[model samples]
Target: MAAFLGMRGTGDWTDSDMRPKNWRQGVLWQYPNGDAPLTAMLSMMSEKKVDDAQYYWWTQGIPAQGGTVATLNDTTALADDFTTGAVAGQTIYAKVALAVAKHFRPGHQAMLRDASDYGVDTRGLVTAVVHNGASSYVAVKLIEDENTGTGTNLTDCDNILVTGSMNAEGAAMPSAIAYD
Candidate 1:
C-alpha cells in the first residue's frame, strides 16, 4: 500500500511552472496487495474551500497465520487500564501481541471492544507504541465512544482492532511504504 499527494489541473503542460494556481490538492492511495485505489481531497484545498474532508483507510485484517486481539492489562477502576477512562480525548494503553504490533502505527485508527459483546466498542487514534519482548503497549487517544456505558470497569475488553486511519493535510507521509 502507498499514498501520494496529487493535484488536478486543466490544460496542463509538461512544465511545472505552467501548473494552474486554482488546482486542488488531494491524497491518493494505491493498494498493491489487491484492492482498489482510494482518493480524497484535503479540506483546506478543496474546490469550495470547505473544511469538511473526512478521509480514512481501512486497516488490513489480522494475519491468518497467527494474530490475536490485544489484551487489557489493567482495569479502569484502579486507573491502570485506560488511565483516564475510555471517553473521547482520553489516551489509553493496551497490551498488543508482538505478532500484530506492526499494524498499530502513529496516526492510525484503532477500535477497542469487549470480545464477548460486539456492541460495546470504543474508537481511538493511535498516538504512541512501545514494543516490549513478547508484546507491545499501544497508546490510543479515544475519539468516540460507541456504546461504552460511563466508560467504567472495562477489564473484560480484550480486543484492539486496527480499523483504519484518518489523515490530514501537512502530516508526514507514511514511512512504511514508498511514495511517488
Candidate 2:
C-alpha cells in the first residue's frame, strides 16, 4: 500500500518498553510490517524525520513483508528487494526517537509554539493516538478558529497538559475534569 504508515510496540522482545536504550541504539525504533502487499517500502524509510537530522539510519534490507514487526528478530537493514520483484513482499522496518515533534493529546486543543522550523501552529482535536512502546502520541487535525467565549479548564497528569483555566464550577485545574 502506498503512503501507508504504521508503528507498533515490541514489548515481547529484549527492548520490551520501546524506550530509548543504550547510547546509539535508542535512536533506532523497530517498525514491524503486518499482512499487506508492499508498494512503498523505499519511500517510507526515507521519510523518517529526526530533528535536524534526516540521516536517520535506514536498513538497505527491509524486513520480510507483513508490517513493522518484520524486523522484530533482526533490526539490521537487509539487501533484499522488498519493493521491486519477487522479494518486494518483504517486511519494512526502522526506528527513531520521539523527540521529533511537539506532542499533544487527542481531542484536545493547545495554544502552541513552534519548537522547530515547521509549519504554522497546528491546533485541533487530537484525533488518533498511536502507542509505540513506552509512550504514545496523537495526530492533530487543524481547526482554524479562535476561542471567544468561556472555555473549558483542564489539568495535567503523566505529562498530558491541560488548559490553565478554571472549571465551570469555579474549581481550579482538576484531574477530575473528565477528558472529552
RMSD to true structure for each model, in Å = 13.7, 26.4
Candidate 1 lDDT trough over 10 residues, lowest sum: 25-34
Q: Mark the 10 consecutive residues where model 2 has the least summed lDDT.
A: 65-74
Q: Taking the tens digit of each residue's C-alpha lDDT, what string does model 1 give over 68-172? A: 555554432223544334567866777767655666677777877776777667788878767674557777777975464644345556677777776677888
Candidate 1 positional error at 152, Å: 9.0
Q: TM-score for all predictions? A: 0.52, 0.22
lDDT of 2 by residue, 5-104 (tens): 4533323335456453332333332333432213222322434345654345443542221111121111123233122111112222211123311232
Off by over 4 Å in 2: 1-104, 116-119, 134-136, 145-180
**lDDT agreement of model 1 with the native:** 0.56
lDDT of 2: 0.29
The lDDT of each candidate is: 0.56, 0.29
